[model samples]
Target chain A: MHQIKTLSNRIRKNTGVDSIRCYQCGKCSAGCPLAGDMDFTPNTVMRMIQVEEKETDKKLLQSEAIWLCLSCEMCISRCPMEIDIPKVMDFLRQESLKEGLQNKSANHNIIPFHQSFLDMIRFTGRSYEIGLIADYKLRSKKILQDITLAPQMLMHGKLPIFPKAVKNRKNIKEIFKKTNML
Target chain B: MKKKLGFYPGCSLEGTAKEYSESVVSLSEQFDIELKQIPDWNCCGATAAHNLNKTLSLVLPSRILAQAQKNEMKEIVVPCAACYNRLSVTQYELLKNDQLKATVEQAIDMPLNTSIRILNVIQFIQEYILPEIPEKLSHTFDKKVACYYGCLLVRPHNILKFDRPESPQFMDEIMQMLGAETIDWPFKTECCGAGLSVSRTELVGKLSGKIVREALDRKAEAIIVACPMCHANLDMRRPAIDQYLEMKTEIPVLYITQAIGMACGLNERQTGTRRHLVKVIGNYFTKTRIPVENNENNPITVEEII
Candidate 1:
């Protein structure tokens, strides 16, 4: 119970999405592109937060809903109360990561992809496609997923071998340090 | 004097979506709009950062905005829709929340400036390119095009405020100005399952497949977009989309800048049309009724025309 309250307050403070403001309107779920794939619909996630049940809240954090959200902002666009459902999902995802909660639905590699993307940016101050793909493949062990497309991508110069690091990379590293991301 | 705007190409422009960056540069040059790249600009944190860390997401874009401010740029043009969304949303958030602004400034070690306006590719075109369309266009695009806004380009209507979030017409209107017939499609503002192109390939295929099918069903010769993610999914992920649909669809997904560049008499190479994975632009030129006289023997071969 205390955990649920702390989690809800943290989400509200971080995302500025008031769980109480969501009035069971299912417009978010209806407009969500990945609603069908989610373990909890967008509305259900919000309702779970409002209900303040610790187990359900933890389940919501561990469910595929947080990982599956595309952050397309469709839910907020259609929300009558302007509840930013995607931001809520983002907060839940951050919480899940901090708590080391692994999503039970492991079919998707979104978590690894997100981590790889951040790692790329943390290293180079910008995303390098080749490095990102390589890192993600190694982490997820799905190296064979897009092997066939490499030749075509290389031909078109879409996959550059070298990444151009930003000039002020020291400042970027300082940013990560100051934000406690390192 | 040429008008200059601060440009943030984002990481995708340097990587998987080089063609978009190329077209944007070429088209902007044609219009005499100088796009000065922001110096030492880092990643905008995109969809991934926000999901992982809120402070990092807000600080990353704020750093870029601070750089633009330092450059004395009044407006920053973000060609990538995802970058535009991140920058615009950060600006909106900073304006509304002083605590966030302070934290972001402290994190980035720079003074925060939320006044620097951020414009997406379409909005930039509507402002700078649309006015000069009549004088610039040498050949009319006589094919039907479906303008796909994807999601971030127009949604979160309160913050973006560029076009109708439900059914945007800025891209369609620009296409019409180039003499192309813009199709009225239902999925114009639909989500393309962005950032999931690599992680959840099957999901992107299903979502982008429906978008492609709708365009094809409406008899659109091509689908025009401004987002690099949309192009990557619709074009590079065509095989996956085909697998999901159990049918092959060869619709060329073009960046709006590419289409505009072509319509303005720029060669295929100049517009970076040769970089597309699906290869529909060649058929687009050959099938057009305008009869490009330069390549009578092989209108499909852009190199021949060049």
Candidate 2:
């Protein structure tokens, strides 16, 4: 119970969203684009955190809602209480990753995709479209998903063959190191 | 000194949205606004970083802001809606929290200055380009356009505070100035499932598919967008969108700058209109003529029209 309280407090502080302020309005879930796909609705996640039940907390972390959130801020935009639901979702995602909580749903590649994006950023100081696509495809094994579109993008000069590195990549690496992303 | 704005094109400009970069450059050139690219800027950590690490999300944008300040840039224009949102939110966060600012400053190893103004393309146009529309424009768009704001440009209203989060009209007003009959669409500020264009292509298709369908149903000739990610999702991922919709929708997704650039008598090449996956603007451009002033000294040449 103490450990759960400490975790909830940390998340509350990190996200700056007072979960207790939520009255289960369900506006966040209504406005969410991916709400239908989420295992747990945005409002339910908030409630679970507010309730601070260990089983609910575990379920919230393990649910596919964290990974499925678009973070489009639509839910908060429509929320009457002006709650930052997306921020809470962000906190949940980080927490889930930190604790190595396995996502309930199978075949969701958002985690690997996010990892590839960060990896590309760390390597080149910016996102390399070609590299990110390759890495994500390799990880997700969805090789032929957008294969047809690649030729068109290349023709339109949308996908550059080589990645452009920033002037001081060493500095970017240092920032990553300090942030413990390394 | 000439009026200049610090330009942060973000990673999308370098790849996947080169046309946006081209059109912005040409549009700025015509408007006499010097765009100084920020020196040694890194990624803003985008949607991915913020989900993984909160500190990294703030730090990446702060570093860019710090570099912009070092370059003596008072006002910065971030054309990409995603980049603008990240930078604007970071600025808002830093202004509201001193500890976070100090931590970010420490992370970046630079003195932070939160006074720099970050402007989205719509805001930039409203401030700088709208007033000069009459004199600069040689042709009117005259076609009905659905200006898609997507999600990042207008949401999280308190932090961004640019236009109305629910129904933004800055882009519509700008399109109106270009003589485009802007449609009153419902999905103007809808989410296009931005970063999921690759990870969850079907979801993007479903979300962006609805937006495209809304535009088409309302008889919008083209869907004008300010964000590169929106363009990539809506334009590049058309097959998925088409598959999801179960119909062939060929509406041209144009950057707001590209639309404005063409209205200013710039040719298709100058505005990077030829790079679109679905070619819809060619007919409109071929039909419209650049209204030339009848002056003895400044004769209208055929080359200008072609």
Candidate 3:
């Protein structure tokens, strides 16, 4: 019971967005392009956060809406309350990850994509596209997807054969460690 | 004083959007805009870092800004809108919150300089290209263009402050000056399924399809964009978009830099015209010859029409 009350308070402290501020205008969901694809719409997620019940709070974190959010600012731009829904979405995603509540119902390898992207930056201090894509494909098991486009992209000099690494590898590792990303 | 603008070409510039990098560099050379590449700069972590870890996101961009500060660079021309947004947003956030700034500095292990101005590609052009180069253009970009300003360039209006969030005219104005007919269309600041490009490609097809369909409906010949992600989805994802639309609404998507390069009389290949997945045809190069003949890249003066 006590934990449920802290959810909304933590959201305010972390993202500066108060769940209670939402007036259920449905403006955020109305503007969201990914609203149809999400397990819960933006407005529904806001409502759930406002409810602050144990079940709804857990479901809110478990919902795929947070991951689906583009953080495009379409909602915040249109919101009457001017609540930063994108910021709230980010906070929810981190919370979702902490609880291992990432939903895999949708055919979206979003987590793998994020992991592969971070791995590229963490290793070389710069993104190695070839490495990133290969790693993503392997992790997500979507190897055949976009295979045809690779040769065309390579021929056009769009796909670099080699990754350009940043000179200071030590600094990148240190930064990662200090940020608790290690 | 050395007149060099710091250039931080994000990961995409090195890969999928190599043409963008090429066109920008070529255009800079023609204008003699001494663009100094930030020495040993890292990736800005992008949407991935922000989605997963909060501090990692700020630190990544902070490190890049810190590197720019080492060279005493005042402004960095971030060609990628995503990178520009991240850098600008990080600067805005860190500058406002000292506690967060201290945490970011500790993580980055570098002296943060959030005061350095971060300019997007459009702003970069408005500052450098539009000043003196427009008059000297050997060729006119006499094509109808829908200037696409994806999410990051102008959205989250409070932080980015460059153009109007919804109906931005900066890109259109620049295109109009280049002698291209600019169309007033919806979805100017719309999301183009940016990072979900590879993961959920079908969604990108549907999302980016709307932008293309509207442009084609309005009779826009080509879509001009300033961001690499927009280009990838709009151009590289053409096959998917076409499949989704169930019609071959194929149109060339050119980077703002590439369009400028073509207007400066550089050939289609020089401006990375060949790199496009949906082949860039129709008024591909300069239609009329100009008087300027000295510059190696500039068009030669015509004696007569063959």
Candidate 4:
């Protein structure tokens, strides 16, 4: 929870908007699309900051609620004094993760697909959908869960069984090699 | 007289989103511009790169920057929002930090080329193409469109300066050039949960469906986007979006270029209209890639490619 102080201090210095200005008006919560799915609504997040309550729910860290914020400026725009609530929330999420607190709501076991995606870009400087999907299915077990759907996708000509690589993979790879992204 | 810039098509041009890319390229030709494909240009480590390693995030796009610099091109035009962000952000980081420049150049084994411009196709059309509008547009796009800037393009505004991070209008300006009515909606620059789409399909589906619904409720004839991922979500994933939300949303999502292409008298095929998932809003387009080279006097053709 050391990140709480870090997040608060950063918000105060950076945004210059007092978290105490919020009076639980619920406008932020009323406007949020993911309010029903959140453990803590936007107003609650603001209230949490006001009371400096030690959040018992470590779920805040692992929750996709933080990342799910569109940063649409709706919450801030609707605020009476225009406090930058989304930025404060973002800093909270970033600091929370830095302190080993993560939102489990956002975490999934899709590392292979995610990793293969990066690998494709790293190797060719572009994605090869066929290669990425193949590598993903080869590495992940969940593809079997949806094995029934892949054929259907291919049947519709939606998913090409074979994807073409960028005509100049070397040049593209050089961009990756240069960035150390490869 | 012609303005020429390096072009990086990313994956969409060669495959699913090929139509959108082709139309933009052809549109550029009409503007007296040459979009020279950056020889050996590659992807910019879009949604995947940053998700894997933060380091690869910068490195992947930095490689493309280096290649363009090596080709002696001062600017590179990216049509995809994800690619544009990766390229623009890498350019910003290198220009901002000298140490990063040296380190990146050392990694790519190329001399750093600093002064390169990173422009999204939307920005290019807004800055370059829109000016030529009065001459070309015979019809006005009187339909309402929700201009979806999406996450990668405007977020991290330090990299892409086309518009406000929270409420962007680069696409709006382009839409206006086409004489389309636009709605000032909340989710214009919002994230479509695109990065989470593959792993968390239901979540993305619900979220994307909501965006579509919002646009539809506002009576937008279409949802306009500059990102391929956003296009995929709002267009290709509509079936899942509808299934998850338990509502039908048939509103079409068009790339900003596709709309511009339409106004320019270019048909659906030229704009990648056929590749979209939702029903094509206007004339049906046969999917085909225009040959890289076309004579100026002849109108571009779009033949269905099997």
Candidate 5:
């Protein structure tokens, strides 16, 4: 458990609000859809706040709860204390990223997978699945990681070698040119 | 006549979500809201890209923004929540990081204008389309619905600042104007496990299942959504969720426009209600409205003509 003095002082400094308003009500935890999956429940995080223990560690940040949060703002809505639980979780995720404490689960391939998807869009002015998947596999340095899997997907007619492109790639490229964040 | 917007429809609207695009086009036409589909629009590279590379993830939408700047469409109307978030976050990053701007621009070969506004369909409707609805409403939906914003509609970034992100009533407000009963439920903007729907089925099933259960628990006749993925995951994936949870939840997850169309007295066929996975509008369409297809992608056929 976090020390009360440290938690209050941090809350006062960062949130510009006193942590004393929270009366250990579990409404936030109760309403949070991701709370059941969370390693640290909303109530626990709030309690930690009262105790003045603010741990921004890998375990805390990398936990599935951090990413699984839908940020629906339900917890705060139901909370009598009006604590922004989702915002706090977002802040923790940011701190975790800054401190390089991100959890890279086996499913961590998603991040790079997304990069490849973007790369295809950047180059072709739209999504090109074949290009994206190839880039993804290449970037991840997983040459034969899913070699057999690819054939299975192809056999199932799920994989398309020639992904569709937006008609007027050049005009789209011009749009990309103007935004400059391509 | 030309409504200036960087139109971001994401993956669903472009391909998998053809009905959403069709309805948006149909409704936009009725209101004369000229939506210039961004020339050469690309995938916003949703949940997948951001997970792989942060820069690439951000750059995907930045590329769209760059195009928007070129076209001079400062205000981007995204029909999809994931796309809206990507575009909004990219705009935030570009305004925040000059180095990132330079790199991303070089990659796409575009000079981003930086003055871009990402608006979701609901925001567009509330800001531009809703007020005009009173004049357009031809019918009324007395049915009670839970306006589910899901996760991406408003959060992290306030692109669509229509309502409180945690407790958004923007959809409810619109629903009220259209003469529908809006239920103030606890799971208004809850996550239906949208992003993980493709990658993690069981997890998304559980998440989506819970959202439906909440709506059913609240006795909402339907769930109105702005995000297509939310519609798909919650509505289309209901059977799986039902099996997983071992409960029969026949709640119809409707698009905000679909409900609005109903209230406005648009034909069920025109609103594409017939194409919905779960039988929606039940027997309501028979006595009130005739079926008509507003085929914007093609021409309106006589058979489709009501």
Candidate 6:
């Protein structure tokens, strides 16, 4: 059981959230709104990190739990030790992508959603709802999923037809590169 | 005296939540306040960036803050809780960690150093409007309402320090100022599944549906919120929510600004209330959107729409 590159070690390095400090109080899981939708509850995920077993770590990475986190911060708000579980969830999601071990079935659309969001920002430097929806539909192939809502949104002026850009979109593209998102 | 405050409407404010932006702007205008958009501001890199990369989240907000600093804005009003949280959290993260701040500064190619106060919509109202609200009120909003804080505005309590983490009272207090009856409810600070409303509609249905349900059971006439994300989940996703709960819920979700605007004599169209998916009922929400021959020239004013 090497300590350096383990999920706990990496999460600690990135977020400064020590999973070792999580006392398995189950308070986080209890408060989390999305706990029902998750494959692994927050407390169970914390316990797996505490155990630090290779099998559990691998299983956790591929699990849909990481992507399911809403980052609602309910867990940390209730946690006695003030463990930042939401931050840990973010790190785990990033790791899941790096290893290409993200759950293919349950949480497949989550990645596409995030990618489209980043792409929207990278190009326009502002969120373009129409652009985001169109790109997400292309990626997720749920083209007609919310197609009906568009006309209503446009009519109400909820969805702007053109993308809003910062005066300097060139800078935004460079940010994606520097952050290694490109 | 028109006091100037930097404005960062965020993406949702410009798009899906333009009504929120409109209400905020019109409401501020009535108070003789000027909200200038922070020059060439970029996206705050919202829930998506934080979910995948911390640096990107920090960098995106850093650019906005840098521009604010460059413009010499002493304080800026961020109407969106998600944007407020991101800017506040990034500032907290950057102030303490010079190393991370330096990296973000390099990425944005600007100085990260800033002390420009970032104020959420609630704080903005409390600071500027609340003092003079009693004097400016054209009428009181007498509806029974639930003040839904959602998350982000109050959570990460150690850093945000805006209100109580779980049971926040700021929005409630503001609603009280508008002469609205604020209901006592448990889900005031709960998660509304705002981040996933677009991609995970079912989950949002369950989460936001529960909030709306709680408000309904308590006999609230409206669910008042300050964040666009919360409004999107509670208002725009009403169909999914009705589907989830197996019941139609029509209690309108109003941004705090919209409620405040109505108090100051701004009509439903002026506050963009007609744009809401759920037709807001009652005397206050009576205007309907009307088509024009040339919308660009005949910008939809309150009188014209009414």
Best by TM-score: 3
Residue-level error in angstroms, candidate 6, position A141: 1.1
Worst 10 residues of 3 chain A by lDDT: A1-10
Candidate 6 residue-wise lDDT, B237-292, digit = tens? 98999999999887888888888887666777668888898877665422223222
- Give me the runs in candidate 3 sitting further than 4 Å from their true place: A1-5, A106-108, B284-289, B295-306
Worst 10 residues of 5 chain A by lDDT: A149-158
Across B128-232, the per-residue lDDT of candidate 1 in tens digits comes to: 998887676666677889999999889789988878999888889888877889999899988888988899999999999999998998999989999999999
Q: Give the runs in model 6 whose Cα sits over 4 Å from its true position.
A: A1-4, B284-306
Q: Please tell me how candidate 3 rates in CAPRI terms.
A: high
- Give candidate 4 misplaced runs (Cα > 4 Å): A1-110, A138-140, A144-182, B281-306
Tens-digit lDDT track for model 4 on A1-182? 35555344555875476887887889878766566667788887776666653453344545556655544445765576677776676566555556666555443334455668877765655677667766776765455544555554454345645555566666556655554543
Instruction: For candidate 3, write residues A2-116 as lDDT tens digits.
Output: 5435578889988888889999999988889989998899899889888878788888887778888988889998899998888988898898888888877422498899999
Superposition error at B47 for model 5 (Å)? 2.2
After the best TM-score superposition of candidate 1, give how far the Cα of residue B237 lies from its true spot, in angstroms: 0.5
- Cα lDDT of model 2 by residue, A1-182, tens digit: 44536446877777767878888979888888888877788887888888777777888888888888888999989999988888888888888888888594523588888889999989999999999989988988878878788888898778899999888888888889878898
**Which ten contiguous residues of candidate 2 chain B have the minimum total lDDT?**
B294-303
Ten contiguous residues minimizing lDDT sum, candidate 4 chain B: B283-292
TM-score of chain B of each: 0.93, 0.93, 0.94, 0.88, 0.89, 0.92
Model 2 Cα lDDT, one tens digit per residue, B181-291: 999978988899898888888899999999999999999999999999999899988988999999999899989998888777666676777787877534443224444
Q: List the DockQ of the predictions in order.
A: 0.84, 0.82, 0.84, 0.28, 0.20, 0.80
Residue-level lDDT tens digits of model 5 in B1-306: 655455766656654455677677667767777778777667776765444334555666776787777787878778887788777767876787788788877766767867877778887888777767656665556677888887777665344355676677778988877667888887777778775554345666798887788778888888888887788788666666897789887777778877766555556565676556555735332123322533223211112111
- How far out, in Å, is residue B254 in model 4? 0.9
TM-score of chain A of 4: 0.59
**Candidate 2 Cα lDDT to native:** 0.85
